[model samples]
Target: MSRAAGRLKVGIRVPPCDRADRIVRTVRRAEELGFDSAWFPDSQLLWRDVFTTLTAAALGTEQIDLGTAVTNLATRHPAVIASAARSVAELAPGRFTLGLGVGDSSVAPVGLRRSTTAEMREGLTVLRTLLNGDEWEFTGPGGTVRSRLRDPHPAIPLHLAASGPRNLRLAGEVADGVILLSGVSPRTLAGAMDRVREGARAAGRVAEAVPLTVSAYCEVTDDIEAAARRIKPICATIARNGGAPFLALAGIEVDVPDVVDGVYPDLVHAEDWDTAVRVASAWVDDAAALRFAEEFCLFGTADEIARRLRALHADGVRGVFLQHVGSYDPPLDLIEAVGASVLPAL
Candidate 1:
């Protein structure tokens, strides 16, 4: 698709908490609703196996594209990731995209950490080489796995889940697409696009040639305030440290306490609702949270959302991936509303 066409690709970030039946139903519903893509996250021991979930999602849907929003290179070698991506592409043909990231916050639970940006860049280089049906030789901790595509090459797009400046730049320089984390404000989005453009130019690629997909946390409801309150916890945590570069662009500051070194994991593993709210509130205030919710999320009336989304398109965003927070039913409501009411206007 032409960049000017500005596709409105809406899909949910499959939470690790969901059940198998629920996931299938969600994927099927997304496809029926005309959503462009559906992405499942990779968290291994923290959650279900990402490739397995993606296979199920792909098998459940007919038209919607399936992807990893992202699978980290820290856990699996690039060749292994390439093999998995190739397998999934075989299952869905042109409907699979491989979204890679450094790793998720859950890595800490298993006494692990994300790979550095340089490591991620090298990993992507390896992944791209393998995906393009080229043979690669590498020596890593796992001895050696020299390989090449023996089967028919699938048209699987490689997307990077980028939050920091280095990763975002690398994504623009190399990746087919970039997946911005949820809770990004318009200012942040614009700044990210600028960075992507800079990297693309440096790499001798047209700015618009590379697809930019912004993922946001959205909950559609008449009571916008209530929805904002519900979304605050998740957004705050993401804002604090997980996606700090983007949130910093939005002018939201995160005052993290020395006691709680990692804000995101602290919020995610918070024992109760009160603790969760406390943890999230520390990073994001009501005004900032509301602004982020309004600017990033597709909330309020369908007409209002459509109008805002059109404005976003005008601003240069190619597509969106809406992450539904809270209950599954609300996401279904938002998806149906967007497809039936908002997308028609677009």
Candidate 2:
């Protein structure tokens, strides 16, 4: 069925792990299943080229919105990102959003540091200038040069994915939308939104004008305790990376080693998810995992998820993009389950 009026916007995060054509099929299927949007993450080493997958998706789907759940300015220059965004926006018109982040897997493997807050400010200005068909200056080894994107797509919305307080505020000041990496805990979400609104007011913008989309791990299961095991790595990673306070807000506390061995790349995007779970289980017990699931994730029956989503919408969340457990495969099951059961309920 088509989207109904006043229904909360729902999206899915699909990895570009396969061929472009095959990835396009997954996006088309999500569209057919009534998902409002499809977001693709970018990591050169981990997945296929994100822009290629997005381009294919744009051409293959008729009505679904498309976005980079996030791409980075570190691995790719702002000019390159602007040019690529314009290309996809050309194909999809008003259906494309360009999401930016400080970078993680996309930069770490390449021996590049993630962009600093100052760098992100500069990068956003450059992107805005180029995408709006205005000239921007670039300083390089060759020399400083001024350039403008040819056939720029100015209307492409720029979303920022942020979890940290500083970045959350930056998103408020500049982004067309905010992609909250903070999970769905009400206390944590409220605190994050306060920072965003503070920045918006400081920048002389209305807080309500900035749409917010929360990114949370979601599962449809009768036995939530068992399914909660999959998020052990996520809990450990959050605690390891300065989110212990956020976890505490959920009444969950964890302390993990700075460097976890055995999991390739990282815990959040571990290739061997079972192994990662095993490694993380030492720090995060079943009770803690269950707590995380209940607080930060949409884990439960369809009715439960529907109620939680409606509550989130009432609390001013405009959209939410559900992410399945694994990063390697398409969330086909999640799409089918939620679309059939949850969307109609919403």
Model 1: per-residue Cα lDDT over 1-346, one tens digit each: 2113346665666654466666778778867877777777776655667787777776777788788887887778787888888888887877888888877554655677888889888888887787788888877789987777566353678888877777788889988888875434677677778788788888999978888788776555677876676666666566555565555566655554435543334564443545666667766777766766776677787777777777766777677777766422325766776678766776
Top-scoring candidate (lDDT): 2
Q: Write the per-residue lDDT of candidate 2 for residues 164-264, one digit (tens) a residue.
A: 98998999999888999888899999999998898898899999888898998999899999999989999999999899999998899899888788998
Off by over 4 Å in 2: 1-6
The residue-level lDDT of candidate 2 at 188 comes to 95
Q: Per-model C-alpha lDDT, please?
A: 0.71, 0.91
RMSD of 1: 3.2
Taking all chains together, each candidate's TM-score versus the true structure is 0.87, 0.98
| RMSD of each candidate relative to the true structure | 3.2, 1.6
